[model samples]
Structure formats: structure tokens, C-alpha cells
Target chain A: MEQHMSEIVTAAFIVIGDEILSGRTKDKNIGHIADILTSVGVDLKEVRIVSDDEDAIIDAVNALRARYTYVFTSGGIGPTHDDITADSISKAFDLPCEHDVAAIELLRDYYKGRDIEFNEARQRMARMPKGATHIANPISIAPGFRIGNVHVMAGVPSIFRAMLDNVLPTLETGAKLISTTTPCPFGEGIISTPLGQIQKDNPEAIIGSYPKLAESGNFMTDIVVRARSEEVLERTTGAVRALVARLLTEQDTGQ
Target chain B: MEQHMSEIVTAAFIVIGDEILSGRTKDKNIGHIADILTSVGVDLKEVRIVSDDEDAIIDAVNALRARYTYVFTSGGIGPTHDDITADSISKAFDLPCEHDVAAIELLRDYYKGRDIEFNEARQRMARMPKGATHIANPISIAPGFRIGNVHVMAGVPSIFRAMLDNVLPTLETGAKLISTTTPCPFGEGIISTPLGQIQKDNPEAIIGSYPKLAESGNFMTDIVVRARSEEVLERTTGAVRALVARLLTEQDTGQ
Candidate 1:
């Protein structure tokens, strides 16, 4: 690919639920969202997991919406009394949340011949903030909503993934980042100094060193280099690989 | 157990690393910390994952430290150039970050006659904010630090766990929340209305409904009830169980 650098597209994720905070449910959405966004050239800059409290939801939604290009929230949109996400999003944007006719019709059609009743409780899924468009859920008929720059989806992993598939295509994406990882059988203490110098020499690339404990009780390090430009990423990755090779040669020669 | 309503101890977790945000590293710390805190009577109120930027780290640290009883941070306290968490923590607390004599001595002793060099980059681990106490890291000799209410630990899972083990004994705990989960072989649409009523009748208990898509393509739900009092928790869980049984009977009779 030719060297191309574009304006960065950033997004923030907000997870609203008491179950997650209480450790009753382990979150499966954050990593999935992060991976999808990165593949589509969107940088997930920040993520916040707040409780079901309305004030906490409002604060996180408002703070992230203003700071990033887009904001995505999951959970608290179900039919239970504890699900206050719609109202909180409405309050955060100063928009009134009311029942959307399209969503109501969709849910009614889905439950038409089924044993389930499209009761007032289930109709709660039809509610959305004003000036919002539906993000269709293929697995479940209840639709998620997109208001302003915020996309709200379900908490269930299958529904969340389906809704994200619907919402991603509508977002603005940037130049995808290119990265390479060089693994060394040494600790960060051995390579940290030269790694810092390599980072300075290659100013266009972002280099990170992560230390991992091996299964054999030895410490190993992985040096990752990332950049939007393929040329810079390659050059920086080469420098890291060369540094590791030099360190290995020194050890072999008893330096 | 005796019925008790003690104060609640709350905590917030902040993860500082671009690796986590970029999806290069799936976070293993949030769930582990959540389970540990809940078991120890400390409610994990919020969680934030931000990049390695200094301003971002400082903002998250300052905001979480002010609001929660304790703030636990993982990642970015290494020797590399991008590892600026220690400096950011100092800026957040407005304290001078200097090399601690004790930490330096400990590291020096650990690296004595080893293949690793106790150079400037490795010595960076000895720096801590003024008035901070060291949290011993048994996996690696480099100690994490606690400044005020924020505990800074390593990004590595083993080191983070070790540091948390060292720090947990010193913190204050509260009345543990008692919880029980009841499984229902039905979708939320069938139980939302009665669940809302049960939640209102048992106002002291916090009830949550999590719907899962089963392997056979049927929707199943788990109703969880939590409370600080054993009597309240058991009573509320019983109400939920009764509600589910009634719904199942109605379905059996074609109501």
C-alpha cells in the first residue's frame, strides 16, 4: 500500500449495567468492539463501564460524546425496571424519549403468532430519544437506536454483535493502522534503553514494549510498532528486530 | 449469618495502556479485579480504559480518586518511553516523583550478579510520587506504589495480581452483598412485567435480568437478586422464583 495518512477517527464506548460492576456477568463486548473498530480504521480512544444509575450513565455519555467522534453504549435498554439507559441518554442530550412507531410495529409483528405478548413492558423496547434512527437487530426484532453521534445497542453478545454489524457501515472511518510485533526471549530490563532510542529515532511510529512471563518461568518481551504509514511501520519494526538480534548475539558471545 | 447493614466500600479501576485500547491485548484485569473486590465486600463502582497519554491518565486518576473509596490502576509503569503512568500519577496528585531509595535498593539487590544491568532505564521502576508507599510485587522485584487512595500496579496479569494481594489486606472492607441467581427458561418478554412488580415490592434488593441466547436458539434468562442483608436477599430471591414458577404454569396451561 502507498504511504497514506488520514485524519484519525476516534470513538468511545460506554457500558451501563450493575451486573458488570457486580461481577455477575463478565463483559464480552469491549474487546469485540475494540477489534471491529480497529479493523475499520476507527480508534477506540476510551472506554467507561458505569453502573445502572441514571446520573452515572448521563455523565459518561455526555463526557464521551463531546470528546470523541462517536460514542457507543450497551445495556440498560431492556424491558426491566432497572434499565434506565434510554431516559439517561435523553437527559444527557436534552431530548425527549418517546415510543417510536416503527420499533413498536416491528416488535408487534415479531410477537404476532408467538406465545409472547407485546405488552406494555415489552413496548419499552420501542422507546428512543428524539431524532434517532433505528439500528436493526437481526437476531432479535427489537431495534437499537442511533441519536446524534451515539449508537446504543443490546447487552447480549449475539444481539450486540448483530447490531454492531448494522451500525459500523454508517460510521466514518480513518486510515487503518499497520503493526508488527517482534518477540524476544529477554526481559524489558535488557532492551528498554535501546527501545527508547529506537522510539525517538522513529518519531512517526508508536512503539510499545510488553513483558510477558513465559510458561517456563522466564520473562520475555514483545516489542510492537504501529503506524498508519506502511513504510514507517516496516522501518520501525525492522529496527526492533535488529535490536533484539544484536542483544541475542551479545549474550551468545558473553558480552 | 447475622443480619447486618454495614457501610459499602467502593472502588474504581483505571487501565492505562494503548495496547488494551488498540485490541492488541485483551484485558484480563477488569473481570479479575471485579470478582476479587465483590468477594472482599468492596463494590467496584466504575472502570475506565484509557491510552498511555499523560493527560488522559492524570484526568482518569484524578476523577476516580476523588469519587471512589479506592482507585486501582494497571499498566504503563514500566521503563520504556511510553510508560508514563508514574509521572502522570505524580502530576495528578501534584507530588514530585523521585527515585525511592528503598525501591532502588530492592531492585539493585534483585538484579545483583544477574544477566540484567541495573541501568538508568531499569532504575526508572524505582520512581514514585512523594508520600507514596510501595506495594510489593512478588513476581517481579519492581514494586508498585500507593499514593493517597490510588494504587498503581503493573499491566502484567501476574504482577498486577501479586501487587493487589499485597494491597488488599490494608484496605477497609464493608458488609458483603449476598446474591442468588434463578434460571428461567423463557424470554424477558414473558417475565418483564412481573419482574418489575417484584422489584418494587422488594425495594431493598437490587434485581437484575440477563437474557442469554442458548445454543438451541432459545432465549433463556437468569434473574439475579443482591442485597446487603441475608434476609432481604433470600426473601427477594424467593419472590423471583415464585414469579418464574407462576409464569411457567401459565405457559403450561396456555394462558
Candidate 2:
């Protein structure tokens, strides 16, 4: 429940991977995080997909962290050569990257009795920026780190979800948006003028019109009205429905 | 064929729609475009998803277009009230959006004998930023347009694909990358130090070590070396193979 002017909590997502850009792998993380954030009332304002370059990661982290209330970065935290996100983040914030004792201990316990030796490469997963907190990954022992407003998570869909489960409880959320939809039988061209007027009238609401190309060779539009309060939502949607009816009547009468 | 030091052509994608942010519609266009661009030797450097708001879209278009060799925007070219991409793109470049005579004629021919009238809203698709050229869409009569280096396409995946097919041939491409991979029995962390040295030795080649979690719970790494020329790729990858063998032999001998 929120008032007319609830403060909005904005977030930005940075998807870091070369596999995505090279078309080797299609990303399955962005939509999952967005759906979760939307349900929790945080506005997913912007999203950026950048490759596994240290300078590129650092630049995006600095810029997005400064711009949004929360910055969520997925990927580039593995034990590989391209896993330079932690070091880049450390450079961006001018912090020292150190091996986290707790993370190292966790990895040791997980890998205990494994045939492969716990070599230097496996140990790289424990290194994080100094003064940062860990985001737990149940699927894999490679814990993601958070410094300031930036939350780092794994690129793998399963591990990222687990880390998010450990992180979502800590952040502050804004008012959840309530929405109403009015379907229009007429084409979008027939409804645009009235919809525009309704949008102008409701300055507090966000209006979006989605068109559907039906298989029956008919086109339809679904106008969605979203607002913080149910009262505003109903008022805007009511106006839209009425305007559509009026326009249809006039078109029928040849006026 | 390019030598070791070929110029890389970079591109940025801007997805303009609120549907993506709200998590109502999952975007299917980014990966499609990225795969095509990569095969043609253009680096898909960055991708940004912004809402249909004018200021947000304009800011992103200007920033991405200025930074990358080319920018492709998808969505907000329909007849609905919230379809504001054309106007925003015009404002981004400080140009006027007008109803292009050619586009209007195309629309008229397309909608001829159709059940719905070609009203103002449908005709709005013909309105693009001044000096913009059309990108043909065979699926739908509404055409995407281009201004300077920014190419605007439809949000629907099928129509967007049709428009991209028409646009890709006209753009210039860089040298197609040549790559080779060397598999390592050890983890990524074990090889990162040596890989970093290899990367330093071959500045023109990009060395990326990707780790895979084996079924036996041990992690193995695959080192991929990318360069503009086959000789550089093979040379870097050869060094990586020798380094892995030496490391393995030393560990087996308990050195």
C-alpha cells in the first residue's frame, strides 16, 4: 500500500560475458532478475550487456552504480582467465582485492576428497574486493561479492538465482505498481487519439499500448495503465474504456 | 585477410520498450542480431534496454551511437499512443520528425483494400526523423528507418529480422576473427597467471580461458585464442598448449 507519490527504487543490471556477445550462449539471467525485481517493487530502469573486458566491466560498474539505487552484475566471477570482474570492481572503487578466508574455507570443504587437487585456479574463486560482503551460492561454492550498492552474482542461471535468494532480503523496496488493462477491438490507429488524451489527463500513471496480431487476421490493442495507487489505476483505466466506447460509437455513426 | 593488427568494428544495440522492463515480454532480438553481427566480423560490444520514455531513449541513442560504429534500436515504431521512438530519435539528433512522402505512399499501397482505414495512427509509422532512410520490412508494410549510424527497427522479432536482412548487406564489416582452443586438465586459476603472460606476449590476440565443471566435480579449462590472422591465433594457442603440458609434467613429477 502506497500513497500517490511513493519514492521509486531504481536498479540497473549489467550482464557481463563474451559468450553472450559471440553468440556462443544466449543469456537466461536478465529476464529472470527483471521479473523478480518487478514483483518486489524495484524499478528495473536500465540493463547493459558487456563483454569480459576488465576496463569495460570497471567502467560500467562505476557508471551504473552511481546512477541507480542498486546495481546488479551477473557473470565474470569464475576461476577462468576472463573472470576479472572482482579485480575490475576493486579497481573501480579503489579497494584492495584479497582472498576472503570464509569463502576459501567454504570452497575447501566443498572440494574435499575430490580427485583433482585444490590447485591455484580453484583458489581464485575465493578472491574478492576488500571490505565487500559475500552473496551465497548454494549451487556452486564460488560466492559473489557486494561492495556499496553493487551486488555481484554468478552468470549461471541456477547459481545466480541462489545468490539472489540470499540477497533480496537485504534491499529496500518501493511501492508495487498496480495495473489495469482495457482491450480495444479497433486498430491502434483508431484508439491512439483518445488513449493519448487519457494519458495526458493522468500524469501520475504510466501507459503502454501493446498490439496483438491475431491469427484470425484481426489486429487488437491492449492498453495498460499502471500507477502506485489502485484509485488512480481505476480512474485512468475507466477513462480509457469510456473513451474507446465513445470513439467506436462515433465511428459507427459516421461522425 | 587481415594481419594481426586488424581494426575491430564495434556495434551497440538499444532495445526501447517498457514491456521488457516490466518483465511482461521477454526480449528475443538481442541474441539474434548479435549472432549475425559476429559472423560478419562486427563486434557486438554493448547492449542497452531502455523504456519508451523520450528522454531515456534519446539519451541512450545519443550515447551509444556516438560510441559505437553503428547502433540498432528495436521497438516503438507502431501506431499506439506510447510508440514514441521516432519522435525521441529525432529529438536525440535535434532534427524534426516528419511524415516522409515515400513512406506515406508505401503505407497507402500497403493498406489499400484492407478492412481498416489508414488513419493517423497507422500513418504515424511513416513519420521518422528528417533525413532518415527506410529499411524494408517484407512481413509488415511499416518500414524501419535509419538516420546517420542509428538504425531503427520494429520490436516484433519477425519484422525486426526482415528489416535486419535488408540492412546488414549495406554496412561495412571488419576482419573476421580467427580462433583456436587448447584444453587444459587443470582449473582456470591454475592457468590464469601463465595465460596472462601469454596474453601479454601476444597483445594482438585475445586469450580467454573458460572453465567447465565436469561430472566428476573437477573443473577443466579451455583456453580460446582469438586474432585477426590464423598465424597469430595458432602461435598463441601453441604457447598455451606447451605451458599446460609443462605445468602438468611438473605437477606429476612433484616439482
Candidate 3:
């Protein structure tokens, strides 16, 4: 596959559940997803946490899938009433959902050795949108689905993470990453103006400053610069270094 | 201040940075903040990740502060050029940016014995939104701000965590949490329908299903029920147990 040069593969995460919005569950999926996507060079642009409402899910799914190269949704796929993600997605794409034979066979094989009964409720897991492919869940027989560019996975952190790992290797990835950082004993404001100038100078590189609160109630800031190309990252980092040096000198001069 | 009986406190998180959007840095702020707020009974309804663009910051700040009982922002408050959160917040609130005497004095006191220069760059940390109070950064002299209901804090995990500890005690919290869980050897689909029925029957109790992926590639789902009152939580949990038992029995009979 010939990859496009300007192809900045972007993805958005939609976390659905009332528990997360209600503050009953602190989400672990975002961090895990973000890290996994980063390692593979896919930029995670936005994350939205919405409730279990069907309209909300449909709206979010539509918006995100339109805006980004891919959309990944976690939660709301179960045998329960609230697990309406599959129905919502089917509605969004105008596709009919029926139990898939391949998925059901996999589920059957999974339960063959165990004493567990594969009931009607359990069979619901085999349902998938027409033309959708299964993202194998090595941990569970109930597979996640990939419909078009959207990957729908379980909400539980462990399962979502496992499903993600299973899915990532199949996707096309572009560049490797290069990053540099410099720590300063100053707050953010002192360097904001200059950093903005550097950013303008090197639009190819991404620059960020993180202000930290020290144990003694003082601020320490770290300026990080990153790029896909190593040479560009080095050049940008050199500029950052000079800027930091000048800022330190200005601090010494009391200006 | 008269607190309304049915009052619900809500919060929104503003994560400002290009780093997170570019996927170079995985954010730790949102998860920590969500956990802290949930523990204190505050609902975290929305989270927005915006770039260091001044207009973006100002817009998000205005919109979030208006909708939520409290708005907390992490990142973009440092001594560097990209750190524009304070100035942006000040502009959003239509407040003047000026060096706060108390904050400056604190910074001076903090750097007294250290070899660090309290120069123009460091002094920038003292600038606060006019009429706003400071949230003490016990870890750093550059204090975060609280203008109206918005709380601005550091982005570093350690510092943000510390500052949150200080700020949390001052906020009013409602209703202690009561929760119980039961483990089931089924995938989410099997339990979804019954879980929905259970939730419909017990509207006040919040029921959630978390599917765990085992090392052997099987699913273990834990159904958790939560409520503000212990009696309600207990009742909901009993219903959940009965539902799970009935479902399992039905599955056995079908097999």
C-alpha cells in the first residue's frame, strides 16, 4: 500500500457509559488507548465521554467518524439493556444486524471445554453489523467488531486494552517518533512569548510546556519538542536550548 | 449559604496542549482529576482537550465555566511561551493580568535560600487574574488560580495531585457512596438485557457491568451496583443477584 505523504492518521476516542459521566468510574481506557496509538504513530486527536443515551452515542459516533480517519468506541456492548452500542452503530450506518455464524461458531468452540451453557443471552454476543469484521478478543469469545473505519470494543479496561492490541497490528502506520525535553526552574509565563515564536519558526515540530508544582510550593517547568523526523527534532531542540539559555540569562539580569 | 436538597454538583476538565492532541504525550491529568472529583461526590460531566491556541483556551474556559459547577484546567501555565493558560483565563473572565503582591512575596520567600534567580521569567509566575484568589501550590511558589468557579492547577501529575488535595477540602461534597459487586462467568451480552431491566426497576441505583479479560482469553464480568444510600444499593444488588441466577439457570436449561 502506497502511503500518502500528508496522511496524518488521526483517531478519536468515544467512551460511553453513565458510570463515567456520573463519576462512579474513573476511566482507564483513554490512557491505555492513547499510549497504544502513540507507540504506533497514530495521533489521538480528541476524546469524548458521553452517557448511555442512544442519541448521544449516534451523534458522537457520526461526528467523530466524520472528523477523523478512524473512530474507536469503548463500552455499551453487552447482553444487558444498556449495551446498545451495536444497535446504535447499526442505526448510524443504516445496516441490518443479525447473529454472525462465524462469530457464533467461535463462541461455541470457546465454551466447548467449559461446563458453561451457551444460552440465548450469550448468543447475542455473536451479532454483528452486516459486512463488519471481528476484532478477535483473545480473552473472551464474544468478539469486538470493526465496521468501516470504526472499531467497537468492550468498555472494561482489560478487555478494551486486549482488543486494541489485537487490532493495531493490522492498521497502516507511518513514522517513528523523536522527542527532546529541557527542565527549567521557572514558571510558564516567562517562556510563553518566546516559545510561541519558536513554534512559528518551526511549524513542523510540536512544542509543549508542562508546569510542575515542586514539593516546597514552587514551580518548575519542562519544555518538550517532538517531531517525526529526527533531524527536524534536533534542530528544533537546539533552538529551544538557546531560548532557554537566553531566558535564564534574562532572569539573572533581573529584567 | 443554603444548599438545595436535590442539588447536583458538576465539573468539566480543560486539558490544554498540542502535545496531547499530537499524541506525543499521554495525559495523566484527566484520569487523576476524575478519580479525585468522583471520590468527593462531584459529577465530572465533560472533558475537553484544546491546543495552546489563546482563542481556543478562552472559548473553552468561558463555555465550560458557565455550564459546570466547577471547571478545572490542567497544563499551559509555565515560564515558557506555550504556557498561555493564565493569560487566556484572565482574558476569558475579562480580568486584568497583574502581578499579585502576595504571590510575588511568596515567590521571594521561596527562593530566598536557593541559588535560583527570581528574574523576569520567574516573576511571571506571580501574575494572576484580577480579583481571583490563589490555590496554594505547596510544591511550587507559582500558585494556581481560582476565578469564580474555575480552578487552574499544574499539569505535572505530582504537583497537580498535591494541589488537588489542598483544594478538595474546601469544596462542599454531598452523599457518601455505597457500592457492591458480584462476579459472573459470562460475557457482557448475556447479562445486558437483565441488567437493563434491573436498572429500570431500580431507577435510583446505578448498575454497571465491567468485563474482565482473563489470561486464558475468556470473559469474567463483574456487575457493580452503586447508590448514595446503603439501603437502596443493597436492594439493587439483591435484585442483580437474583437476575444473574435466573439467567444462568435459563442458560443451563437451554443447553
Best by the DockQ measure: 1
Model 3: reference contacts kept, as a fraction: 0.58
**Where is model 2 chain A poorest over a 10-residue stretch in terms of lDDT?**
A246-255
Question: To one decimal, what is the Cα RMSD in angstroms of model 3 from the true structure?
Answer: 4.3
Question: Where in model 2 is the C-alpha error above 4 Å?
Answer: A1-5, A113-116, A181-186, A216-218, A239-255, B1-5, B180-201, B211-223, B236-255
Report the Cα lDDT for candidate 3. Answer: 0.78
Please provide TM-scores, in order, for all candidate models, with all chains considered together: 0.96, 0.89, 0.81
- The list of candidate 1 runs beyond 4 A from truth reads A1-5, A252-255, B1-5, B113-115, B252-255
Candidate 2 backbone collisions, by pair: A121-B189, A121-B190
DockQ per candidate, 2 decimals? 0.60, 0.47, 0.38
Displacement of the residue A18 alpha carbon in candidate 1, Å: 1.1
- Model 2 error, position A226 (Å): 2.0
All models: lDDT?
A: 0.88, 0.84, 0.78
lDDT of 2 by residue, B111-223 (tens): 77464577787899899988999999886678999999999999988789999999988788888876777787876656777788888999989888766666665557777
Question: Could you give candidate 3's per-residue lDDT for residues A104-142 as a string of tens digits?
Answer: 899887667666667677777788788899988876657
lDDT of 1 by residue, B79-181 (tens): 8888899999999999999999999999988877455568888899999998899999987789999999999999999999999998888888889987999
lDDT of 2 by residue, A103-122 (tens): 98888887773444566767
